[model samples]
Target: METVKLYVIVFDSTHSAIAAETMLKEENIANEVIPTPREITASCGLSIRFNIDSLDKVKNILKQGSVSVNGVYKLERRLNEKQVEKLM
Candidate 1:
C-alpha cells in the first residue's frame, strides 16, 4: 500500500496544542504546529500535523495525557512531476 503523508489534528485549545507538541517531541515524534486548516473546525485555530505512521501513537498520547483533540484527518498533496522527480 502507498504510504500516507499528511495529517491534521485539532486541539481543544492553543495551549493544549503546544503541550501536545512538547509531549510528542519528548517522545521523539516529528510534527509541526500550524493554524487550523479550513477543512477542520476548531476553536483554538492551532493544530499538529505529523507523519501518518505516527497517528496511532500520537492519538494514544493525546488520550492518555487528556489532551483533547477534536478531530484527525489524513491529507495528501499532489506532487507535480518536477517535485516527484526531485525526490527520486
Candidate 2:
C-alpha cells in the first residue's frame, strides 16, 4: 500500500472556510470542504482539503483575499494509520 499525503487548511470560522472555498473554486483551484480532523482543534468544524502540491498557490490566494487561517496541516494516511503534522 502507498501512503497518501494531503493538506488541510483550518480556518478560524465557518464563514471564512466557506468564503475561501468559493474563492478557490472561482479561481479553478481544486479543493473540498471537510470536517476538521480530530487531531486538529480549530474554531470551526469545517476545513479545506487540497492537494499538497497546491500548497503555495492556496496560501497565496488566501493571503491575497485576507482569509484568516488557523493553520495548515499535512496529513499522511497509510493503511489504517494516520499522522498529522502542522505545516504553517
Candidate 3:
C-alpha cells in the first residue's frame, strides 16, 4: 500500500478559500477545500488538503494570488485498510 500524508491549509476567509480552490483547479493541482478539523481554530473554518510533494507548487499559486494561508499541518493515513483487515 502507498503511504500518504495529508497537508491541511487554512484560509482567513471563505472567499479566499473558495478562490484558492478555483485557482488550484485551474492549475490542475490536486486539492479540496474541506471543513476545518476540530484540532485547529481558523478564521473561516475551511481548509485545503494536498500531498506534501505538491506543497511547493501550491505555495507558489497562493503567493501569486495574494492568498493568506493561516496554518498548515501534516496527517498520516494508511492506504490499505482492506489489506490490513484481511490480515486480521
Candidate 4:
C-alpha cells in the first residue's frame, strides 16, 4: 500500500463520528475510524481518518449529508514525530 498524508475529521460528538464512518463506507471512500489524536484536542474522542486523495469526496459527502464536524486536521509525521495541524 502506498502511504499518503492523512486528514482527520473531528466531531463534536461520537454519534457524528460514527455516522461519518458509515457515510464514507457507503460512498466507497477509503477511511477508518480512529481515536482522535492526543496531539489535537477535540470534543469527541473519536474521529474519521482518510487519505488525502479522498479529501474532496469526504468534504462533499459531509456537506451534502449535513454531518456536523468540529474541525478537519492534517495528520503528519516527520522524524518519527507526529505533527497535527488544523485545516481550514
Instruction: Point to the candidate with the largest TM-score.
Output: 2
What is candidate 3's lDDT per residue for 3-79, written digit by digit as tens? 55568778888888888889999999998778976556645899887766877888788878877777667655565
lDDT of 1 by residue, 1-88 (tens): 4433558677788888998999999999999998876655544899787886887888788778867667776654455211111110
Best by lDDT: 2
Per-residue lDDT of candidate 2, residues 1-88 (tens digit): 9998879999999889999999999988899999998878765989999987788988888888978889889989999999999888
24: Cα error in model 3, Å: 0.7
**lDDT of predicted model 2:** 0.89
lDDT by residue (16-70, candidate 4, tens digit) is: 9988899999999998898888877856899888888888888888888877898
Whole-model lDDT values for every prediction? 0.72, 0.89, 0.72, 0.84
The alpha-carbon deviation from the true structure for residue 74 of candidate 2, after best TM-score superposition, in angstroms, is 0.5
TM-scores of the candidates in the order shown: 0.75, 0.88, 0.73, 0.85
Tell me the spans in candidate 1 whose CA falls farther than 4 Å from its real position: 1-5, 77-88
The TM-score of predicted model 1 comes to 0.75
Residue pairs with colliding backbones in model 3 are: none
The candidates, ranked best first by TM-score, are 2, 4, 1, 3
Worst 10 residues of 2 by lDDT: 36-45
- Residue 79, candidate 4: Cα error in Å is 1.7
